[model samples]
Target: MRTRPIGPYGTAVSVIGQGTWQLERADRRTAVRALNTGIDAGMTHIDTAESYGGGAVEQLVGEAVRHRRHEVFLASKVRAANASAHGTVAACDRSLRRVGTDHLDLYLLHWPGGHPLEETLAGLRALHRAGKILHYGVSNFHDRHLAELFARTGPDEIVCDQVLHHLGDCSAELRVAPACLARGIAVVGYSPFGLGSFPPSPRAAAVLDSVARTHGATRHQIALAFLVREPHSFAIPKTATPSRAEENAAAAEITLSDEDIARIAAVCPVPADDGTPSSASGRRP
Candidate 1:
């Protein structure tokens, strides 16, 4: 699979990773098999959160990567409600225990919360100093959130910003993406398919169908490829089926043409910059 640099430190991560939003809802054997299959296929960046399935999914992820943890770039998130300095550290410890890992490759604040951003960054920095986490980031953060965060912390302290970026919504392109790119912070797109309501419009469906046929791929694969087409972008699509995991991983090999991107843009136009907030509805924290 193709890879991209995730931070200023030059950590390479697969363009297409694995998202464990609701993996706990899947059958135990199938979910484990799917995660292992993804890793075997080079989708080694597994993203989970302490809030997922009330932490049950983290245990499942631990089981899947138990023997091959060295082959994976493990990441997980701490909920907003637990963004306090001490709470952040405590939450990470619990996540580590559940995932059966001594340290996380990447840790993130699930979203903006009532707690001050300084406390969260202090907590993350403490973890970094303790070797409990290699890097830290944010998810569902918008332009203002990024501004506030950068004001309190150096750009190097942040590695990535995981947000809702899919074919249906490209609002992140307005400011969040540009700001991150300027700072060398990767934009890791989550829910690239958009609530399972993909090919949001007839025109989008037609464009996707044409592109998929041209590449001999499925619409889903085309969507994933499009999401990670840029060098600073990455994606984590969830799947509990081994075959689907393979399909998602294959998207990394696809190279969409300029014409193909233009066609997709025409059908699924990026929303105009009207100060509308990016969607943060998926994978609740």
Candidate 2:
């Protein structure tokens, strides 16, 4: 898998990262196998959250990668309600203990909430000062929130912003994408396959089918290819099956033509409002 520089942390992550959302529910053997498969496939990044399985997922990830921690970039998030400095500091320590790591490559605020943004950012800054986290970012933030964060915290302090982005969900394109592009902050796209809702339209499916036929790839590979094709973009798709994990990692090599990209973009309409799905409501994982 090809790797990209995430930010000032100098951590190089795979283009296709693994998302550990439902990993805790999988039997320990299955979880270990899937994670090991991902790592062997050159997937150097693993995204998990403290809220996932109420901390079980982090524990599982910690165990799976303990021996190979240097080969992977580990990232996690603190819950939205726990945005305060105290809460964030405590959460960071808990994540470290669960992951069996001394420091996280990247730490994120899972979601924006009622807490003062400055206070939340200050908490992350404190963690950075203490050498608990290498970099800090946000998830599920809109353009306004990003701007607020940039203004108060300054541009260099924020590393990246993660959001739900797929062929079917282009809400980030309106403001978030452009803003990030201009500011030099990488955009981490989660659920790049539209959460399994692929083939954006009949037209898109037709185009991808032809492309896949020529490249000997699956439709899912074509979908993920569309995401990484974007500059400074990274994708993390969750999967428990080893085969699916391999397929997702293979997407890194499936390059698309300009015509194919245009055709897919045409069928997948960019939403006037933010493309975040209404069903996206859930705890971070």
Candidate 3:
């Protein structure tokens, strides 16, 4: 898998990282198998959150990587409700315990909350100084939210913004992703398949299928590879099947031609016209 840097001195994470949202509901053996299979396929970045299955998913991730922690760039998020300095520290400590790791490669604010942004930044700064987390980021943040958060924090303090981005849904491309890229912040795209909830329109499917055929890849890989085409972009596609996990990891190697990328981008859904309404509605903390 191709890798990209999260920070100047930070490790470069696989462009096709593993997303573990709602995986706690999956059978234990199946979940563990999917995660390990991803690792075996050279996917080193694993993302989870304390709120996932109320930490059950974190536990599963812990068990999967306990023996190979050094090979993985583990990441997790603190719910906005727990964004206070005290709560952030304690929450991270618990996450470390659950994930069987000494520290997280990246820690994110799941989303902006009723809590003051100052409180959240303070907690993230404290975590950085304490070395509990190497880098801090945000997920599901719009342009306004990123502007608000970066105003109080360093321009480069944010390592990335994890947003919903794919060929079928490209809200991040318009504002959220450009804002992050301009500031040297990586954009970690989640739901490359729209969480597998929205099936593509025939027009979009045909385009994806054409690209997939050209590259000998699946539609899922084509979708993911397009997102990771930029040096600072990453993709995390979730699945409970080991074969699917392996396939997602291989997407990093499928480089899209400029024309191919342009074609895919042209067919990508825009917020207002996307048949799937409520493009970024789910995954709220």
Task: Please state every model's RMSD to the true fold in angstroms.
Answer: 1.2, 2.5, 2.8
Stretches of candidate 2 off by over 4 Å are 8-10, 273-285
**Model 1 regions lying over 4 Å from their true place:** 275-283
Give the least accurate 10-residue stretch of model 2, judged by summed lDDT: 276-285
Q: By TM-score, who's the top model here?
A: 1
Q: Pick the candidate with the highest lDDT.
A: 1
- What lDDT is reached at residue 237 by model 1? 94
Model 2: per-residue lDDT, tens digit, 1-285?
Answer: 888877545567798899888788788888778888999999878999988999999999999899999888889999977878788999999999999999998999998874888788888999999999888898888766876777887657777888888887877766787787777777898877775567767787887788788789998898888888876789998888888889989999887898878877777767666455332322344
Model 3: per-residue lDDT, tens digit, 25-131?
88899989999999999888999999999999999999999899989999999988887878888889999999888899999988787478888788888989989
Q: Over 4 Å off in model 3, which ranges?
A: 8-10, 269-280
Least accurate 10 contiguous residues by lDDT in model 3: 273-282
RMSD of 2: 2.5
Q: State residue 10's C-alpha deviation in candidate 1, in Å.
A: 0.2
lDDT of model 2 at residue 247? 94
Clash number by candidate, in order? 0, 1, 0
